[model samples]
Target: MAFGARARLINPRLGTYFSIFAALYTALFLLVLIFEQLKFDESFLRIAFLAGPIVIYAAIGLCVGTNDILCYFAAGRRVPAAYTGLLLGASALGGTFIVAGTGAFFFSGFDAVILLMGTLTGFVIMAIGLAPFYRKFGAFTVPSYLGRRFESRGLRVITAGIAAVPMLLVLSAELRIGGHVAQRLVGGSANNLVFLLALTIAISTAAGGKRSFTWTGVAQSIALFLAVLGVATTISVMVTSLPIPQLANGPMVRGMVRNEVNEGLQLIKVWPMAFQLPPEGFSALTKPYTQPFGSIGPLAFIIGVFAIATGVSTAPWLLPRVAATPGVYEARKSIGWATVFSGLALLTISSAAIFLRDFTLDAVMSERLGPLPQWLHNAAAHHIVTFDQAATRLGFAGLKFDRDGVLFALPLLVDLPSAFSYLLLAGAVAAALVTASATTVSLAAVLGEDVIQGMSWEPPTTQSRVWIVRGFIVVVAFCGAMLCVTAPSDPLRLVLWALSLTGASLFPVMVLSIWWKRLTVGGAIVGVISGFVAGAFAIMMGEMGTLSTPGAIAGILGLPVSFALAIGTSLMRPEVSRHTVEMVRDIRVPGGEIIYDREMQRLQLRKHSRT
Candidate 1:
């Protein structure tokens, strides 16, 4: 039994499993393509496209599931930095970043780049300041690390509860977005699809925990990249007669700028102009595609970036990937790869937006327009964009596009084969599933391991612990689905709320725990609670119209308050336990056995002796 278990832990045979999945999906794609050629019903093809990858992902998860605690919890700590990076990158971007970010870029133009910039900055902060230390500490969850570092189980439980808020918010948003994509593909009520999506995610997460999450994440990322590249490349060839969308988009942007000006379109002043408005008044047309600061003010832009970057760096869902790496150096390398992969996708999305905007301008502004263009009708059929032909003229002002649906509707707008449209939605669904699964898996680990142990003062047996986590996965996934279906906010706003709350509540306390030996339980508790309250209040006020500022930047107010309270509280209680000081010193070293593993062994030994 020992030998069999050891072999199972040592060898997941992930490459073979992925190869099988690849073959299966390729066959499915060919089948769908044949049906398209044969003029089969469009709804049938849409259902196939939406459901095929999901079934395969679930199969992969079930195949990878393991009863061994190490394999289930952390993939036996053997994943290479590159694979870990790919997984992290995919999860980090999620459905919201790919779908909503692209839509925001399509509409907001240069203003959206500010958010991307902040998200990328978060990767740098994680790589430099957080990932290595967390990996070196070797906790299974963020709350676990906090509990161990502070030497207080009560603090662990509190921190676990606090961390769940942002992660849950993110989980619901991803599910909501996923359901929306499904609804577009299959023409059904989104509420039912959301529950279905939640069940699928829970099954995958519960089956193998992070072990399933890692390989599936890699597969999902590759699929998303392919879909994005396919649409971008096709559109680029049409626009610039070149294959490289990122490079080709430059000329197209310039053309759009010149065309807009010639048509008497002026930049839309998104925020009130600081001084008098320009002679070409704001009401006439859309903003120039390349113009900056027209959609969002500089102050809000800066605040949004800062808040998002900080929150992303400390996100609880990301740290488990760090612990899954082989060592501190590997953890750092993993985050570096995450940055590269995410940056590549972001750049591709940005270029795609420019091409899309150029297409929209041509369709509306061309003199040859006789009836509403086929592209507009096609887009309208899917409810991707709204327009009133009787009330409004044929310009940007006449159409109000759905930000969530813009990327999904891109292929149809370009008159590509309807298959490409399904492919784009497939990519969006893949991203959503991977992120939702990762978030569910991480939250399960927090609640099952850290929260449970902190409350009970005694760890359950390994078998029971794995089962407990599996149960929590189902519970958490369903709760998220219910929230998304019943009371959904904009996916982008939900993401921002999650980020702001995370940056405010956890970041300051977490950073101090790593860098400051004087950080006490009282300080962490006060800082987390205070920051969380301050950020939540700001978001509420912003939403209620009580505060003039945008809700996206509300977390900024919490950062300073958190830092001051934590620092001052620690100073007032200056006594430091020797063991905690040594633990702090030990985590900073890159080369050492995992501290969490050592502590676990001690605990197990003590329990055995007591028995």
Candidate 2:
């Protein structure tokens, strides 16, 4: 009771703790920028900027390391909503959103808003429909929640195996992007850096599981916010003389539209599902910035948004973080806050893309300019932006830009202080590390607890279980890092693929299990298998170039089949028990003892009586 009281006292102070960390992190980077301006060695400064926060995050993880069962797995269920929200928001942004996602906006123009809308819409669904109820049940992993809800250990094990696919995909995406940023900083092989970054993630995750995961995630989020918003605001003030990037990009967009007309860019009305790229002699810069369906088709856009949003709503890594919150209401509130933070990060990214595009249109492609700017040359040296040898002045057909490197290249492109570029690099790495840690830890928990323990009739001791999870964290991080090095995909597409898989395979059954009490174990098992297979098939086809937009298409094919299968199967085998029906009814209520905990206690009592 005294410990609980002390925790309550500390809970409200979390915001203050994170705020101080943000201020100090910003101030340290500012000092580094000042040193760079004062003729300090660029190499040392780059190392310091990237390495400093990671060291602190590891220290924090070590300090918070725990063997207590609940705290290890769920942060003692004491984190305040605001901090939990920060954790969720930061993990959601990942390395992909701030890095490759920014590049997508720069190239795809209006078509990229589909990604933003999908993510924010997913947050809304969680806030209203999913998160609170999950909190009330208080399961450690999504598989555990489903397994217990259906009273089937086999279902839990099967779901754990299926869910690991998308979680590892997300982990690989974060590691790949993080390694890229690290390589940009230190100028070494990205494969080595990926392994190194994975070590850092393992340290942070294995130290305290979600307990350490939460605090490190908050620190990383603040770093990301400082770097991304700081760069956007500075560039906004320089370009438009306004500090707010989101509200100040209007004239820039109009400027782009006018430039597109001057360049004689014409839109091709392709079939709605056809894949389109800029025609030869045309580059992304030569296309209309405000036009829709210029790249991804209209049907693909809608499907992409739906897939991403649904995936976000049901992400195993994301939803389990809600278990750290104090109650169901706090979980809902945290999701609301997550929506705000992620939405802000995304909008700032779009605004930054606009200002960067404005730079290219006004300077790089200008007929009067004698040669490409030194910044573009520098970008090309980094292999960030490429140009055609046969390229003519004002013709974009000869230019190509790598989307994944755009965010790191933006400050240089905009001619900001080189220090700002390093700052952005640090920020991107932080985002990646935090997310990689979250996904790694989630995979470990799902496999370690939901699968290994669920398969055993006898539960392991609390210490053994914690050690088991820590061991799995290291293994999972290694696998993800190796995957990143071995078969790297575009980070943005990887993210979308993970979201599509999670949404397609898990969302329908998760929802039905909560609202439809008649859902039988056979129905759920079949539904999960069917959805996963369909989603995986579509993803493979897309990867093989059979589909224009595989991530979105996966959901379009998988969701309906899963929903139909689960419902039809349930109706066919209408044999749900009265107790399960009562449990589902209880979960929907906001205030109650955690339903999962009560059920576990009853099972324990029965076991004791039998023994």
Candidate 3:
């Protein structure tokens, strides 16, 4: 009774401490907003506004640091539902959403909306189908869950490799995007910026692992949402002359589309019909701006949505957050909160893209009579926007705008105050940092715990395991940073690729492991391998010019392939043991010991016996 009393008391106090910490950071963020409204030197304001939040994040990580592996791996499994939900939302709203997503919307029109809807639907599926069950099962990592659920160490190793591929690829893309933001704000070579950002992510992640990420993720979510909301709302009102941009931006967008159509028609009269083209080329040759699918097409749009939604539902980086929740109820509730928050942010992002597109057409593209806007001038100076004289006759002078630069360049295009631009940049960086940190930690934890330990006869000591995770964190960070330097891809494309791969390779297995008792070890292994290969082939086809556009639907192919293989192979193989069957049954229902510390449970049992 005394031990139980002590335990209950400690958990609340820990909650209180983190609550206070979060409140302090929130207060500090408000103060920064106040400061932004005041007059200050451009460079000084930029540095201070940008550095303040990052320093606070690092400080939080340092304060949260612990040697306890459970604390490091799962934030002691005591994180509040609200915070975990916010972290998941923040992780979902990475640089791709804030930065590259805007450009995608600019180019693809309503196709991007479908993708956002798909992502939100994924969260709903997670809340209803996966999160609660995973929390009940109490696995620290995805591979660990799969390994125990299927009773196969080799499957665990294979899952780790599959998880690592997308995580690393996505991390590298995020780092490259973050580096680009930093370079624009502070001025440095892209390679150096990537290295520095990678180091910062490594330090913050290694400092306290998931504990640090949880706290920092809340702050990041707030910053990113505010940056996006503030800019979009203000710009929407400016364009539409209405109080609510969410509702009011429609007419403005329509007018802009009409203008683009008129310009395209004028071009066709002067040049050949084939020669007059939209910015996205052949796929959007007719009424590009007004079309629902634009260059992406309807099939691709539907596939992209499913691929992204499934990806979010089964993302390895996201699953651990669910496991860290305090109970099955909270785990389920948290997914709803994450979905709501992410949905709001996406709404703001899509609105901003439409508003910015209008601004680009009126202010930047049509300003052929005089000097370009200061924002466009600076963007061109940075090589973010380039002009090609050869295509000038088609009503667009090959005004090649880097999609990744859209979010960063939006403020400048609208002539917002420099302070606001810096804040936007900081938010982009925060978004990247949140996702990068989570991915890094997940990579390390899975590699160390599932791959290395699962292969060994004798497990390492707790301290050794902790060190192993830390070492993997460093190695993964370095490798991802190097990839950022040499093989940087578009942030949104890379994110979709990662998501599609995860959805194809892991989502089916995760669902089956929790709900399907017939899932055999051999079947799971074959499913993962075959799914990965098929997904990779689909992406390769898109990249190699076989497809008109990148096959966002590759997961559509891979997922069915995996499902068939798993079902077919499981039928051919022996049934899993009754013990495994019972375990699955138990996980399906709610109400179990939420805290999953095996060692602590053992000690508590001993104490009860002695009493």
Candidate of highest TM-score: 2
TM-score of the candidate numbered 1?
A: 0.93
Write the residue-wise lDDT of candidate 2 on 355-412 in tens digits. Answer: 7777666654456556656677777777777875344464554557777676766677
lDDT of each: 0.81, 0.83, 0.74
Clash numbers, per candidate: 0, 2, 0
Error of 2 at 554 (Å): 2.6
- True-vs-predicted CA distance for residue 594, candidate 2, Å: 0.7
TM-score of each: 0.93, 0.94, 0.86
Model 1 has an lDDT value of 0.81
Q: Candidate 1 or 2, higher TM-score?
A: 2
| Pairs that clash in candidate 1 | none
List ranges where model 1 is wrong by over 4 Å: 1-20, 268-285, 366-372, 388-393
TM-score ranking, best first: 2, 1, 3
Model 2's alpha-carbon lDDT is 0.83
The TM-score, computed over Cα atoms with residue i paired to residue i, of candidate 2 is 0.94
| Consecutive 10-residue window with the lowest summed lDDT within model 1 | 273-282
lDDT against true structure, model 3: 0.74
Q: In angstroms, what RMSD does candidate 2 have relative to the true structure?
A: 2.8
lDDT of 3 at 11: 52
Kindly give the stretch of ten consecutive residues in candidate 2 with the minimal lDDT sum: 274-283
